[model samples]
Structure formats: C-alpha cells, structure tokens
Target: MPQWWKEEIVYQIYPKSFQDSNHDGIGDIQGIIQKLDYLKDLGVTMLWICPIYCSPMDDNGYDIADYYQIHPDFGSMEDVDELIVKAKERDIKIIMDLVINHTSDEHAWFQEALKNPDSPYRQYYIFKEGQDNQPPTNWRSVFSGSVWEKVPHEDNMYYFHSFSKKQPDLNWENPQMREDIYRMINWWLDKGIAGFRVDAINFIKKDQSWQNGPVDGADGLSSCFEFTRNQPGIEVFFKELREKTFDIHHCMTVAEAVGVPYDQLSIFIGQDGCFSMMFDFNYSHIDITEHEEWFPLQNWTMQEYKEKLFLSQKEIFKTGWCGTFLENHDMQRSLNRLIRNPQERTPKAAKALGQMFMFLKGTPFIYQGEEIGTINNHRLSIHDFDDLNSHAQYRRALQEGYSEEEALDFVNRRSRDNTRSPMSWNSQLYAGFSDVQPWLTNNEYYQDINVAKQVNDPDSVLSYYKQMIALRQNPLYHQTLVYGDFISLESEEYVIAYMRQDDQQTILCIQNLQNKETHFPLSSKAQVLLSNDQVNIQNQQLKLSPYQATILLIE
Candidate 1:
C-alpha cells in the first residue's frame, strides 16, 4: 500500500543450490546473473536471494562471519555488484536476506568477545555467568542441546544461541550493536540493493531475565517460546531500524517473524509499522506436534487449513498486506506438504495452489523449484543429512523408541534439507545445478520436472506459474489484484473461495482443496480468467474437477 511492493512478485533463490556457475559444488551470484533474463521472462518483478554473506555455513548462510564481505562460495563483492547491475537491467529488483539476529561464533566480534573479557565487543553478544555450575536458564537450542555454551577460558561464563552453538545471539540491547546493525543495513541500501527479507528479526530482543519456562521437550530444557521469543519492546528496535535505514531509502522489508500475537499485527506491519509485511506462520505450524516433533504431527483437516490461511489474510487485509507463500527455504514443498494424496497431486494441483495464492490480496513469492512443482527430498540416511535441525530431530526420534529407519523417514518428511536440495534446471546430471557434485543431492524426479522440460510445455506447472504471475501483474488487472478489497466466500465444503473487488471490476477465486469433483453455485454468467482444470458454468452452477482452481470474472 505504501509503494510498489504491493504489486511486486518475489522469487526466492537459495543461492547455494540455485545454480553453480563455477561448478565448485555450490551455486554462486554469477549463476543468478545468468538466469536474470529467465526470471524476468517469467514475470518475476523482484528476487529475494538468501544470505550470501561471509559465513562458516554452520547453519547455512544464516550465521554471518562478516557483514561486509561476500562469501567465497557465493562469489566476490564484484560479482554481487555485477548481479545487482544485471538484475536491474532486466527490471528485477534484488532483495538481500538480512540476518542480523545473530552472528557466527567465528565472527571477529564473537572471537574478540571470547578472548577479551573487558573488550567493548564483549557486550556485543549475550554472555552471562552460570548458576550453581548450571546454565543461566534451561532453554533448548533450536538446533539441539542446551542454549548456553561455555566460553573457553572464562570461568563458568557462557554465551546463548537461539539456534546452533556456532550461531551466537547478538545483544541488541547494546547501543553499539544496534548502531552497527543499522549502519550495515544502510550500507547495503546505499549499494543499490532494493530491499531485504529480514531473517529471524523477531528474536533480536530478549527478556534478559534468563528465567526458565515450563519444560516441554524430552530434554529437561524448555522451548524458547515462553522465555526469549517475541519479548516486549521489540517494536522500539523495529521503529529505529526503519527510521535509520529502510525509510531513508524507501526499502521494502518482509520479516520472518514467529510467535507474534494477532493483537499486535498493526505494530509489526501497520501503515507505519516495522516492515512492509511479515510471513504468516499459522498455516506452516499446522503439522507440528505438541512435543514440537514432526514425526507425530497433528491431524490437519482441509477445513482447518482453510480457516488458518483465511484468518491470516483477513487480519492483514486491515492495516497492511500479506506476503503469501506456500514454500520457502525453511519448509517442505508446498504441494507435497498440503496435498496428502500422492495420486491426486498432479501438475494441476500445483497450479491450483499457485493460482489461489497469487490472486489473493497480497504479494506472492515463488521459491526456487516451486514453480515446477518439486516434491520433498526422498528418504535420506543420517549419513546423507546436512541440516543441523534435521540431525537433532533424527537423534530425538531415535531416543523416542523409534528405529533408525523410522527416524530417518520422519526426518525425511519435515527436514529443512528437503527444500535445500539443488534446483532442477534440466534433466542433466545434478539436474544441471553444477558440473560437480552439488553441496546436497538433487531431487530424483528432476528428470521429469526440471525447468528445461517445463519451459516449453504450455501445460507444465512452471508455465502455469508464469501465466499466473503475468496475470497478477497484467496492466488491466494489477490495480484490482493489488488494491482490491478481499472478501472471503463460503459456499461449499472442501472449497476455499474469495473475491477481490474494486470499483471497476470484481474477480472471484475458488479452489477445491480435495481430490474429488465438486459444485458451487454461480448465479450470474462468468468468464474463466484462469483455472487449473477445465471447468464451465452450466445451469447457474460451476463444475469443479479434482484439485481445481478457477478464477472468474462475473458478467
């Protein structure tokens, strides 16, 4: 609503797996530059590249070793400059991933903090003494083990990490730290980067009391939910951040916010709130269990999924816009996760999901490989796993009286590594991601679902996404899709319908969540704008096929 972001279509690229130009077993900025035309042709207005900063890659690129330098695995600073220039030439805006919540333990500041107790950098990160030889708080690391790790040569003192021990949480309460982060943000904006996808930003602030919450996991440690997550006064930091950096350059920011309450939506993404939009995790959390394990997920019904997604859309429709996405680097494939019936999850189903979200009153994001309807990684042994979270969960599964094979299967379904696999550019070896062995294994079905195979097929999932994106950005419909009022429609079971209404025109979007044919009332004559399956209006009723998604303009 503030500017052009509402009309933008973002495409997320996991740099390490996107494409390897150098064939160094890793993707790089040059590869992205080479594919800029492809993205532009697909109607991608903006690109969100995951962290390519200098890092140890302990948790991929989230653990930054240096904010100013580009990781060698990604490319040189010159390559980044070239990417920005090339992307701009193709009218594609580049959105950097902002991961300021923490830094790698190998970072200079953290290294300095470890060696010198009285150094100014010591206060840059959270470090405190233990109580009775135990950790200050019984908090569990998101990756695994205790959140507190003993600082070498510092008697009984330890540092806290919300994620892996290698990624230590920064002390945002420190004014110098906040100033440094602001400076870094401005530095990137000054370098022609359009905006940022702020990562784990909600966890920047903490309660500081280090009080233990109710133990919820098999381990004695408690989840960070009640203790360190979404503490009071985080808005103060957000406000300053926007004023000092984003506001100056009018940069767009989408935050990876978790645990934010519905009541405070305005503070986080209001007219003048923290970011342009924050990811709504209500639907993403639908599959997790009470013990926070993915093996024994809660039974999720189609009605529940619809209600959850609708609640998010309806809430953000008030003050700000929603950032609608089905899959990202952190989650499983959208179609694979949502459509339980493997037999019914055809290319049509993926297109239906794509159309349903793209037409919604929000900016739609297409993750790499998502356009082609890639599924999750196949069964992986513990030896083949790379993600720290997956390793932790697999170990937990084994401890929960499950066999090794069972644990592997459970982790296979929920591991973030599923999304981290190399992008399938073609049917070639390594799916044309790299000439050498990729950092991770490529999905096996790349032979049938690669971009090279789909780009020419008009009925392919990729082609459908291109059409959906083009339509969303079409001159005649852009205003209606971007600024129109969102109205939830309730007509039939196993169907989610909504309307985007503007003064000039109204568009109706309907999707059949089930794998069976269904019918919905359609009184007036309507024209099919876009649909996954062939459906027509007859006798004042619309016939929908299995997993159908239809958009209609009323006559």
Candidate 2:
C-alpha cells in the first residue's frame, strides 16, 4: 500500500441500473468493463460497485447465496477478473459490497439448516421456535415488520432478517461462521480488490440474549436500534474481521452503519477498529418524521439543516473519517429530492450540498448519474416502480387512509427508486442503459441530462464533479481535505460553509442553500478554485446566485 484510497474520490455503480452492454435489460460485469472509459473520463479514482455475488434477488442481491460465485445474471467470475484488470488499467481501484450480515433464505447454508437440525451449517444461522405466537423477540426488520421468519419445516421456529424474510441473519455467535467469513474476505482480498463496503454491518453483532427491544412507537414493533445498533460485542467481531481480513492485507473497508452512536464510533472505525470509514446517513434521514413516515416538507429550515449536519460532523470528523453522499442506490437523487426548488437545477444548491459534505474531512462517494445533477420523477406510479421499499410504504400509506394521490406524492418524493432509475448514457430510447427492456424505467428527465450531452459540456454537473475530484486530489487540497480537522463557519442562513485546516493551509468551501442570492464574508483575500456558477469570482465578498458554490484558496 499506497494510501491511494484515503486520497481518492469513489464513484458508486449500482450495476443492474448502470448499463446493459449485451442489451440484456440487466447490467452485468462486462457492462461495467465496457463503461470503464466513461468512469475514467468522469475522473473517479475508485469504483465501489454494489454486490455482484450470486443471489436470489429477493432484496436485489443483498440476499447472497454463494459468496464465491458471481451471479449468472451479472456475468461469470472471468468477467469479474477481467473488470478488475480493466479498472486497474485505467488507474481505478475496485471495491465490492461485502454483505456478510445475512445470507438468503434460499442459500444452501439456510436450506441445510432447515433440513437437519444437527447439520453443521445450522450453526451459521439464527434459528429458534417462536415464543407465545410472537416473534422470538420484538426486534423489527428495517423494512416494515418483525425481523424473524419461521422456517416451514420447523414449526414455530424462526430466522432473523434485518430486511426481508428471504434474507436470514447469520449467527455471528458461531466460531465456525466467523472463520468462514474471514476466509471469504481473504479470498476476495487475495484476488486484488482494493477493499469492501460492508453492508448493514451494525446488524452483525446483536444482543446475544435476543432480548425484547424497548417499545418506541404505537405500532408496537420494538426499535431494533435500541438493541441492534452497535451492540456491545460488535466491536470484537469487527476487530476480528479487521485483523483477519482488512488489517492483514490492509485493505480499505467502509461500512453501511446508519445508527452507530457517536461514543462507539471510534471503536467501530478508528485506526484499530473495524473499518476505515462509515457512511453518514443522518443527512439522508432528514425527511423522515418521528414515526419514520414520509412527511412532506414545505421547507427545510437553513438553521435546522445546518445544525443537523454539524452534529454529524462534530461527532465523526475528529475521531473517525466519514463517508459523504447526497444519494445512493437506496436513496432518492440528491438534486431532485432534497432541493426545495427543483426548477433552478440549482447547481449552486447541489454544489452547496456538495461543499457541505465533500470538504467535511472524509471520503466522498458519488452515486452514478448524481454527477449530472439527476432528479427524481414525480409521475411514476406505484405499479410502475420495482423498489420494495416504495411498494411497502405505499401500502402503509393506503392502510393509513391516505388517498391514492396523496400516497403517490409521498412515495414519488422519497422513493429510493428515484436514484435506481437507469443511468442516462444518452438521449436515446431507454436512455442507452439497455437495448432491450430495462430493469427500471429511466426518468424522462434523462433526455436533458444524459452523459453524452454533459460529457462535452464544460459547465455541466459532470464536468464540475470532475473538477472537484481534481481539487481534492491536487497536492494543495489532498492532505488538507483528508486529514485536516473540519470546522463549520458559523453563518445565519442560506448556506453550509466549512474550513479544512492542516499545518500547511486552510481550504474554505461555501455552498448556497437557498434559491436566492447569498454572500460569504472572507477575512483574507481568496482565490476562487472552483465554483458552480458560470461567472467568475471578482470580489472578495463571495457573491452566490441561488445554489452557487465556490471553493476558495485562502491563507
């Protein structure tokens, strides 16, 4: 190792929605290989692809079956090896999703467990008889209902699923299971992947007692976060995982940990802990109500938004590195969903969002199409959407007596399917994602925001992202952006501005949040390094025209 990842900009590719090279209507590894040049042109140094492992597709590849085998739908293991080679040739590191929290109910391990209670594989999964007609405990799945699923063969018995019942939670209590996981991690590392993005990692270690979680709502489903978030013994599991897999090879490991508390974060991701970084989900959770329902927002208070962001920054910025993003495969597009004013295309607003997180002393992840200022569509019906979360939420809204129109608005505004829309390669039919039918419908906005048009436009979001990537890697900002301590520039409203300072220099980044003019007072003479605005920065008092962002060089 080179600490390349520490200084790199990662682009996340959700394969199924990325490109369909063979026109198969599904994205495969070969398609990813075909798109390497496109990714290269965008200036991403690392590629973090969602899982391509063999899966049942119950939860869209999260329900893994064989860890060692690539899904046939995605292409062969040879294709994987070839993609790795092709990516490395373009100087891009590749990281695969490591979803070890659970295996699909269809996985051989689970089936074997179901067949014979005495079988060795039974030890790898959680299996117990339901007590008193209720789930073994009240821990609810993050999806909607109880986390436990009763095996058909074993009457009253159940398996834990943090999401879908088809995905059974693995029993980390078994030493044999831990060894197997370590072996698999080594196998992947040995194959030369740069690292892993551990999925639902906080759910791996649970309360061994499987005790009832405290009731936090009227629904009666116990809050899993109370007992499931960063359990007392999870660090040991991660430290062991790090020691056997990451530390040994020193591979980079980032985690999908949403509710990881501030006090326990250092232990979960510090230098000696489980991962190199953990994604900050609080920003995405902004739209969520106290009941975790889709409550429409007339406006996001600039004061409140700034304070919520600062809480995450203040907690993780010092003790541990953070992974920042506006959207991902599991969330709506940032520009389309978060902006109060969608008509502005608000590159300034988008850039300000970027400025808020990118300069926050961490590795920033860019979801595909996000670089092109992708937005979510409000017209797609519930029937047309393929996302499970959207479907579940729609049903819930209907059950709660919301009218069809009312439910549609909430679902459209918040569905993760907004981002799952196919990558717009061109203005062609199907957005050039597939020559055949696509896995998901492309947002009609693709006609204006396709990669073909933006790839050639210097003022495009794609170009701006490339420029920011360059600034972060540039010698001046690399050290300062990565290891420096982040400090928020206290402001009244309309922006989230911050400074990253090391011994050498301090990099100030200002982003405008409102769809109106905003100004930033810079104490020293500053040079505009990067700006979302088409106009040049002339005066020292930063002038931002609605959602404009400027990264500055100040002494």
Candidate 3:
C-alpha cells in the first residue's frame, strides 16, 4: 500500500452543493478554497471532489464534455490551479474524480460521431447497427429504459449508454480510446493534483460478444451489468492504466470497482495491484436489492450489517487495503440508513457510527456533511427531485401500481438528492451556502444542524469527528490503528464489538447500536481511550448508555 494514502482520511465534496462562493446557487472551486481551513481543522488530509469537469449536467457532471477544462459553473481552470496550490500550503491533497467510462452527448467527439458513421471519432464510442427497428440489445441503462439510443437521421444505428441517454458509453475495446484516456489522466497528474478516485472504472471492459443478456426486470430489458460488469480482460485495462499513469507518478488511486471477484482482491489492491485500494460497497448496499427496484429493499439487522462489514475488512486486509465509507454522493445519509428509528438517530448515535468505521483496517472517507451528522431529507416530492435515477424510479413505482404517496416515500428514503442538498454552513440565508436560492433546497433540519452551531460546541458531532480523526492520525496509536489485525467479538443483538491488535497492543472498540442501555461483560483489563458517553464500570463489567461507544486500550 502507498503509506501516505493508507494514512489519509479523505473528505468527499459534492462540488455543486459544498459551498457557493459566487452566490450563483452552486458550489465552485473558489468556494472550496474558501473552506480549506475548515477541512484542515477537521483533520482530513485528502479531498475527493466529485466531477467538476465541463459537462451538460447530465448525471450531475459525471457525463463529461471536456476532459481538459473545468466547468464554467465550477470556475475557471485558474481557480482549480489555485485550489491545488492553496491546498498544498495546508498540507492537503486533492483527488479528482476520473470519469472516463462515458462522455456527454454534447462532447465534440460524440457530436462528430453523430454526423457521420465513418468519422474517426465514431470509434471512440460504442455504436452499432440495430436489428430491425429494435435496439441492438435488450440491456437496460442504469438510469432507466433502453441502453441504446438511436442516432438521428441514421437508419437502425444506435449508441450504447450505461447511464443516461445524454451520456454515451466509450468503446474501451478501441485501443486509441484507451490511449486517449490515459493521456488525459497523465495530463491532470502533471498539474500537481494527488491522483484520482476512478469512477465506474470496472465498467470499462465490455463483453466482446454484445449478445443480449437474460431479462431480469418487468420492463423486458436485461440489466447491462449482467453482461458487462467486471467482465473478463478488464484487469488488462487497469494494469495498463496503472503503468501509464499512476505507477509513473506514484499517485493514489481508489477504484469504484463493483462486482470484483472476491478471490481476486489481491489483483486489485495488492502491493503491485492496479490501485492503492478499492471501495467495498457491501455494507452501504445492505438496503438495496438485486432487482434494481427500491421499494423491495431490506433493512439490515445488526448481525447482517456486522457480517458484511467484517467480511469486507477480512478479505481486503489479506493482500491490500479497502476504502471504508458509510455514505457518499450516491447514497442516502448514514444516520438515517443505520439508525432507522427516527428518535434513535441522534448526534450521539452519529458519533458512535463514525467511530466504529474510522478505526477499521482501511482508509476512512468522510462525505461533505457526514462529519456534521446530516440525516436524509424526509420531506421531498417528485416535482422537487432532480436526480435522473430517482425520477426514473419514482415513475416506475407509479406505473407498478404504487400509490403516489408511497412512491414519493421511497424516493425520499432512497434518492441521491438526500445527500446533494446544499451544505448547512450556518442557519442564515441558504444555510450560509449561498446568498441566492440553492440548486436544491437545504435540509429543513439545517437550522439546528448547521456547521456554525456545531463548530464551537465541544459535544457536537463535528467535534467528535475531529477527535476520531486525531486519534487515527495520532503518532502514538497510528501503527496499531492503520495496520492492526481486526478481530470480531461475540456480543448480543444491537451491539458491535471488535478489537484491533498489533504486535504490542490491543484496542477494543465497542458500540451499542440501539436506544436501550446494555450491560457488557469486561473479560480483560482495559483503560478508556475514548467514549461517547459517561461510563460506569463495576467489577469486571461495563454499563453502556444508549448509543454509547468506546475505544479501550486493553492492558
């Protein structure tokens, strides 16, 4: 593992909502510059900003129109250069979101591809002749509907899109296209940024045969992932990617690689692996379903959640590292997902959840508002939604006989919009995010949960995050926390206990996930290193308050 990357605590920023410096109702590079001290003080060493490239806003900037330029809404390339320099001054690193799986339809390459079938750029994207009047395949896009979009003025010709129609999938089978992507990545690295959080990189390789996949949905369309996800030969692309870019610069790379074979974990993150680490989604995906439908989601029992977390940790620790996170721009807030009971989702519980993951055997990532314990926005309507995936799911629910209210409830619970809401910096105008209206509404609870209210409070969730980060980066416990072996402890329902052991020390971390106080047996000698609540210790026993968590240094 790269020692620097392993020691990092990455903070993800959804650029459009993080902070609006120009008051244009959108966050920008300048906005990020304005908040560097805040992040530095929060104890994060790396910043992973989601796509801020030139785009048509399809998929919220994931659909890139220009790789070399920053989106105007995000400020000029000069602002980005300034951000890198400024961040360096504070000893922080910036990791860009590398999104080469697809490009916006408005991109010049795609536009040229549309004008003529024989254009040189045509080979840059996946375009094929349709069978009769139907699409070339039965695959469904991730955003919804058919994966293929017909070319205008062309007979039975279509282009494939794994996501939105406005975003056309790139043809990784084309060697020139791969070279182009590599060159673009190296160009960015030359600009002095740390590296990239590769987006949907696992989707780059496609099944050589483009045959239709088995139907798995009511729409008669097969999931594109069924045929293309983590397909064979994909590793070849990554190996080359690393050689041409990351390996040369010795930069950090965390891949968003879904459906990777468990046995092949070493190939993805080992010392000579393609990436420094890869995100493990098993824990965050507990509420999801295989059918891609939201309504039939399952709530994780404490055991189920713990099992998933343990498995991922154990597997990754064998050969390489993992990127541990409870929430990102794509998922609903962690507090709402982990603590289902509304009343149980308090700041104290949030702190416990944060502590549980930060000390695990991996790099911990804190999303923009995660440090402040942001919860899902429960009040939302179909009309107020902007996320294409959420809007598609809402329409699907209505067509499948769900009541309008029920469908809206599902959207409220599952929408990425829940995390896209502008950061609540202060209680004032636009939660101190902007002077004008934000692109999306600020969370209603922001008035009480804003950063200004918690930044100075000793007991705030923000403060607890600082404490946890400091502990993880603390010189005294650094080695044990980062390289220790994780051992799970047998405990009752609604309780999670684990130990991190290195050559000379054992750190026991315990948490009560429920609202009721629980009695825990103390089977060893220990001293408190950290705790979310006041604890009572009797003769070889521990009495833990509701949602309490503690890190104990076992003697």
- What lDDT score belongs to each candidate, Candidate 1 first? 0.86, 0.80, 0.89
lDDT per residue for candidate 1 within 1-555, as digits (tens), equals 257888789999999999899969899999998888889989998999999999999989999999999999999999999998988888889999999999999999999999899999999999999999999899877776888999887789999898999999999999899999999999999999989999988888888777887876667778776666678888898889889998999888998887677887877797778898888887777887643567665689878888888888888777776788888998888877888877776888888888877887788898998899898877647888888888998887776678888888878888888899999999998899999999888898889889999999998999899888877878887888888988888866589999999998888999987878889898688888888778777898899888888988877
Candidate 1: TM-score? 0.98
Name the TM-score of candidate 2: 0.94
Instruction: Give TM-scores for every candidate, taking all chains together and pairing residue i with residue i.
Output: 0.98, 0.94, 0.98
Query: Model 1, stretches more than 4 Å misplaced?
Result: 290-292
Q: How many backbone clashes does candidate 2 have?
A: 3
Q: In model 1, which residue pairs have backbone atoms overlapping below 3 Å?
A: none
Best by lDDT: 3
Ten-residue stretch with the least lDDT total in model 1: 289-298
For 1-555, candidate 3 gives per-residue lDDT tens digits of 336898888999999999999879999999999999999999999999899999999799999999998999999999999999999999999999999899999999999999988998999999889997799999988877998998999889899998899999899888898898889999999999999999988888888788988877667888888776777787788788889989889899898977676787766888767999999886778887764567755856888999888888888888888889978998899998888889888999999999988888898999999999999887646988888889988877776678899989888898999999999999997999999999999988999888999999999999999999999888878899998899988899788889999998999999999988888888888899889999788988888899999999888
